[model samples]
Target: MPSLMDTYIENREMVQPNHANNLDTVHGGNVMKWMDEVGAMSAIRFAGKSCVTARVDEMDFRRPVLVGDTAVIESYVYEAGETSVDVYLRAFRENPRTGERELTTESYFVYVGIDESGEPSPVPALTVESEEGERRQAEALDGLDA
Candidate 1:
């Protein structure tokens, strides 16, 4: 089994585009795409198989990432079901040169594990041993309640 820390940042990306948006700032769709990709990677790492997005509870583009800036997204599994892992995803806009960052977006996603046959397969429960993990899990539950 991969260590807990390994599950946190495995196979992520730092996306930079021509600009944040076609008009001027970053595009909302591009941010969503990045979120989905990072979320899926967390699920696959935890489940040890392929996974697909089952649902996104909520996605909010609170801020815009400008062009030439870095869109750094972090994804980690916070909760799990028999065949699903709920991932907590957060994105920040960073100045590539200065390394300054600001929270730009966040969302909760649910993904289901798939076996070699491409059928839903069971995934282990999420194990939260640290305060941070617990807080993130709580945030996901609180999000569902809202």
Candidate 2:
């Protein structure tokens, strides 16, 4: 079994001109790409196998990350089935100098563990062992109801 905390991952991307739109803000697609990458990493950590994205739930962008800001993507596996790992992901716009951060986007993703032949593979059971891990799992479950 793998603890939910074991699947946690955080990645940061610098928002540069190439990753931004004409308005000088990070593009929505770029944000999604970052989130997806982080989410997949979490799922793979939990599954211990190659994982392929199966589905992405509704994603909402609450704010734009301006160019020069750091895009911080955090993800963790909150739940899992026989072969599917459910990951919760959130992205924040961080000011490197001030260390201030604000939520920019969030989404839920599903990834299926795969074998060498491309068939679904079983994943170890996920456990929420710590108080913080339990809280995070609960929060992700609560968001699913909203």
Candidate 3:
């Protein structure tokens, strides 16, 4: 069994000119791309197999990452089913100089494990070993109600 902590993933990308929109902030699509990549990595770590995006829950762009800032993405597998895994994803804008961080986006992503033949495959069971893991799982479940 893989614990949720084992599947934790964090990544950061510097917002460059190419990554920004007309407003000089990171584009929403670029942020989504980053989220999906990190979310898939978490799912693959949990499942120990190839995983593909199945769905993405509502994503609200609450803030913006300026061109000189860094986009920090965090993800973890919070729930699992027979062949699917649910990942909790959050992104923050961090000031490279000040180290200040602000929440920018959040969403739930669903991924399905795939076998060697590209068919759906069973995923490993997720074990919540720590208080934080339990809390993350609970958060994922609570999101379902919203």
Winning candidate number (lDDT): 2
17-84 per-residue lDDT for model 3 (tens digits) = 99988999999999999999999999998999999999999998998899999999999998899999
Model with the higher TM-score, candidate 1 or 3 = 3
User: Model-by-model lDDT, in order?
Assistant: 0.79, 0.95, 0.94
Name the lDDT of candidate 3. 0.94
Task: Give the per-residue lDDT digits (tens) of candidate 2, residues 1-146.
Answer: 89999998999999999998999999899999989899999998899889999999999999999999999999999999999999999999999899899998999999999999999999999999999999999989998998
Which candidate achieves the best TM-score against the true structure?
2
As for lDDT, the candidate ahead, 2 or 3, is 2
The reply for model 2, stretches above 4 Å from the true place, is none
Q: Which of the predicted structures, 2 or 3, would earn the higher TM-score when compared with the native?
A: 2
User: In model 2, how many backbone clashes occur?
Assistant: 0
- Candidate with more favorable, higher TM-score: 1 or 2: 2
Error of 3 at 121 (Å): 0.3
Clash pairs for candidate 2: none
In model 3, which residue pairs have backbone atoms overlapping below 3 Å? Answer: none
